[model samples]
Target: MFAPQSDRVALRFGDRSLTHASLAACAGSLARELTGLPRVAVWATPSLETCVAVVAALLAGVPAVPLNPKVGERELAHIVADSAPATVLAAPGVDLPAGLDSVPRRDVTLDGDDPGSFADPGDEAPALIVYTSGTTGSPKGVVLPRRALTSTLDAVAEAWQWTADDVLVHALPLFHVHGLILGVLGPLRRGGTLHHLGKFSTAGVVEALEGDGTMMFGVPTMYHRIAEEVGTTPALAAALGKARLLVSGSAALPVRDHERIATATGQRVVERYGMTETLMNTSVRADGDRRPGAVGVPLPGVEVRLVDDAGSVLDGAGPIGEIQVRGPNLFTEYLNRPDATAEAFAGGWFRTGDVGTRDADGYYRIVGRKATDIIKSGGYKIGAGEIENALLEHPGVREVAVTGEPDDDLGERIVAWVVAAGDAPPSSEELADHVARLLTPHKRPRVVRFVEALPRNDMGKVMKRALRT
Candidate 1:
């Protein structure tokens, strides 16, 4: 995939860099060693070694399971036992967790002669077995086939107008799909340059975009930080203004931050929607309108529909319902969980478990997850995302998460968990009124709790489940 641009720079980690020729040579050498393995586990730290290991596994036609470095002992143990990898790959001199001790380790080296071209692996072959966050129960290993990767990558490339000339920059972790698949492989498949920030900082963003960085991928938290300082930091705004595209994913970027950044830099941040099971379903097109709160239309070759509780497909643009998708972007199945895999699909369509609505222009706006973001209160089904976005517009609201709690009268009462901005925080009543005025009276928070900060996961998504507790 990276052969055409063999001489061009492909991957950069801090000061270290690798050309396409060098990366292919190293990965090809490693691929020779990985051949015929049932599956290999990659200690996916944000580094060049992790990138090479994954590419090598794919080249060898063996499934690669990316292990999060910060995984808990029990979760790690579960993944290790479930996948039962033949061996684990990591960088030299790194200490692996005790949970991975069961598997033999192989140290990846950059210096290696190319093994020459290899035969094409069939598209049906499994490429990566990515484990979900396991919020509902134990993490299920999601089996993503080669076709899914290629199709999703091609679809997104078409949506963003991405090409070899574009230089992508991001600081997302290597364990998940956003960072590994799109952030890493997307560039490689396009034969483009990818500069991975060892860590994310507004300063790092400025330095990168100010250089040759043409595009950026980040979550809402990162963009929120950028929005907070971009107005005051002229360099940041200037760098962003020079970029071709700024993309946000993993979570919804608040409308307030979108306006702030666009106002300061004259560049609107593009948001896309996807999950571990489905690589990418929708994205705001590069040539289309950059609407805030909307994730844009479904990508080419992918189909999306909204379904009601009765399993009836909802039509038109106004109704909010659970989103279902169908396309080559769908994952094959959950490893070792046939029942769960069957449960994930209905009538040939994958149940996304995410609730959303479409506009007249066919743009999709995510309301939140069906399990947590849908609030049934006062005989109305209100989406938590709209309320959260409304609350974010208030001056005193720094960060906020909206959830539904048990209520005798309303069935589920809307509650807001807020991280206030200034010394004088907005009162609960004031915040409630603010939401009611912006949205609807029924959507207003019946209860409000202020905190120093909202609990977030590694990807910067608000842990609404944690907040509910």
Candidate 2:
């Protein structure tokens, strides 16, 4: 979409700003260098260099697989063995493993070559392979196509009314779809400038807001921290008001936190829904009322249905069922995992494994996930999110994770791992009593353990399986 006169900035890092023309030239040169390489693996270390490699790969028709650069040796080795890319673009000083061509940023040469008018790829051709957050154990690479990108961008733009003037403050990482595709690609496709940041801090984010940035994209945890940081500063509060829209994703934004952010920032964080398999399915409106806890109607052209265990569609709004989706943005398949891909789909609709209920107003509320996190206690199904939300309300709690622990009597018991805000947290009995006041007695956490920090994977999702182990 780059024209000679196009007023767009492709990247902004520190004092440097790469124009669309420069970015196009660099991508083409990188593409030329990567010619004949079977695959390119980018260990996503937050940078403009990583962005250049990704866009260059797309333009070059080479499959680019991005791995979590922050992961340890164990996780990193698994990704390298799985994808086996011919070339790797990584941060400087990170030793390259055997049998891969690694290029450092300073060594790469870029003499202008046009990133010619991009011709959108077929619906079946693989464009990118994003790994799931290996919260369970090993992560699976979710293969997405070019059509998925275009279709999703169109749908998102239609539903949220994104414009060329909108500048996005990208706090999320480039490795995750929410951060890279939705945060970077969505705005770029509309000819918007992405004010990129390597890491997020209270002052840095506030500084980005002071610029031309009109929109903000972040996970719920970030909003909570930013809200806390902006407690009583009128200047910071007014700076936040400059943002036209704010999006919350990766995890659902709790009602209390959402309200707290809106009160401090003057912009209600619009909650949306998506995963690695499907880039984005639904989003709250840009101009209308954003209902708390409900991911508003599906984006344009995306079909959503609630189905029971029998795969039969539910007719009422009161019951929660598996949220299934079939859309243009849905991935073509899981990379080389035919059986796993086959298992993910049922009657053409991809089973999201998430349980949700639709309201009369057409808003969808996520209740729980099917496999790893959802817990059933006594005769009632419990969503760990409820307890986690309530736990966050306590002033002593810094972070909380709830999971199902096996029990002989209730079939399953609620176990919570908490990171305390202060040096000393409340006693387990006291914390249990606090949760009991907010949740039903049966739903209250029976086991509360104090920890320095909750174990998390590269993507920042809590590793509940590891916690159980």
Candidate 3:
């Protein structure tokens, strides 16, 4: 890909840009310097240097572990000790944290070997050691091979009609699969150009779209902000309306936001489903039905199935079950934890804690997470996602999260935590009635709590455990 697009700009961050030839030369120089290292830790920031470091590690066949720039001290210590990288790769003048300061540092710069190509790592070789979020306790390192990375990027490209002519624009972090692999590596694999906004801002998004941006990718939080502004900000709406393709992932985008953006821009943002373990299982195709909440069918080369608690395959109209997937896009293993690795796979399918239902048309709709989003209330299995979507339609509701709380009468009672949109939010009774009218009375929140904001993970997923606590 680089050999042909030597003079073309491959990446852009703020005012800095890297042509394909320069990217190759710069990364190759770093690669040659990191030749003997078994693995390297990249201080993943949304910058040209971070992009160059990742490309260099891949070229050198040394597995790269991306550390979140905003990582907590405990998580940082665990990652540093577990991966045991020979050195840390960082942008020039960027200060290392206490845990990483002791490690040898290599400053990534454009002044490297002359423009040339290097051998790509084998498809089966380890490419990344991305750590899972420490939701349960400490995060675990997920080992991803070159095969998984390429297969996922290729599938997404085919689905989105992505090519060198398409210029991608985003402002997501570079520490995770959504930001790093799909956002950065995706464009590179297709020989396309990437414009990163450094950090997400409505103004930045509008600027990029107003320019040469053809495709946009964002998490739910970013889309939520877009939804808020698009109604009153015609310029922002126009900018988004001009985008060739809009995608939402990492966390589910509320149906209300989808509708709002669609109504304003005449574009339905495509949604995809994936995790740290499975790079990507399904996505609403660029040409497929752009239903508000559908994650669409499984990507090409990926197999998805729904099974009950007893492990029986689900069939027929609407049976909500846990998602089990099998594909080359799956990660190789959790680094240094064979027991955990074995537990993740059953037969050959990887168990995704997510639960969802599949329609006859093959569009899969996410219900909620098995661990937290599934509400066992009054002998009914209600998914928090649908209720959250329904509640989002309420005019007074700005952000909402649904959960199940303990109750004496019912096994669990549904709870709705909301952030009001205006000075006066809708009454709990009125909001509950609204949801009942939209969904069902049984699904309405038995208790509604107003809050300043919903606690969320970096990807914008509502942290249900925090609400429970």
Best first by TM-score, ranked: 1, 3, 2
Scored by lDDT, model 3 comes in at 0.85
lDDT of 3 by residue, 1-469 (tens): 2336467889999898998878988888888888768999999978999999999898888999998776655557888989999999999999888889768998889888654456766788999999873224346799999999989998998898999888899987898888899999998888889999988889999999999999999877678788888989998999999999999886667778898899999989999999889999999999888999889999999999999999999986589999999999999999988988898899999998889999988899988767776665543446677788778888999999888876543446899999999998899999988877655466789999999988989999778899889
Evaluated against the true structure, the overall lDDT of model 1 is 0.88
What's the residue-level lDDT of 15 in candidate 3?
Answer: 91
What is candidate 1's lDDT per residue for 277-327, written digit by digit as tens?
A: 999999999988999999999998999999999999999989999999999
User: What is candidate 3's TM-score against the reference?
Assistant: 0.80
Clashes of each: 0, 0, 0
Clash pairs of candidate 3?
Answer: none
Q: For each candidate, what is the lDDT? A: 0.88, 0.74, 0.85
| Rank list by lDDT | 1, 3, 2
Q: For every model shown, what is its TM-score relative to the native structure?
A: 0.81, 0.77, 0.80
For model 3, the stretches where C-alpha displacement exceeds 4 angstroms are 1-3, 373-469
- In model 2, the runs with Cα more than 4 Å from the true position are 1-7, 91-112, 117-121, 134-137, 373-469
Ten contiguous residues minimizing lDDT sum, candidate 3: 131-140
The C-alpha stretches of model 1 lying farther than 4 A from their native spots are: 1-5, 373-469
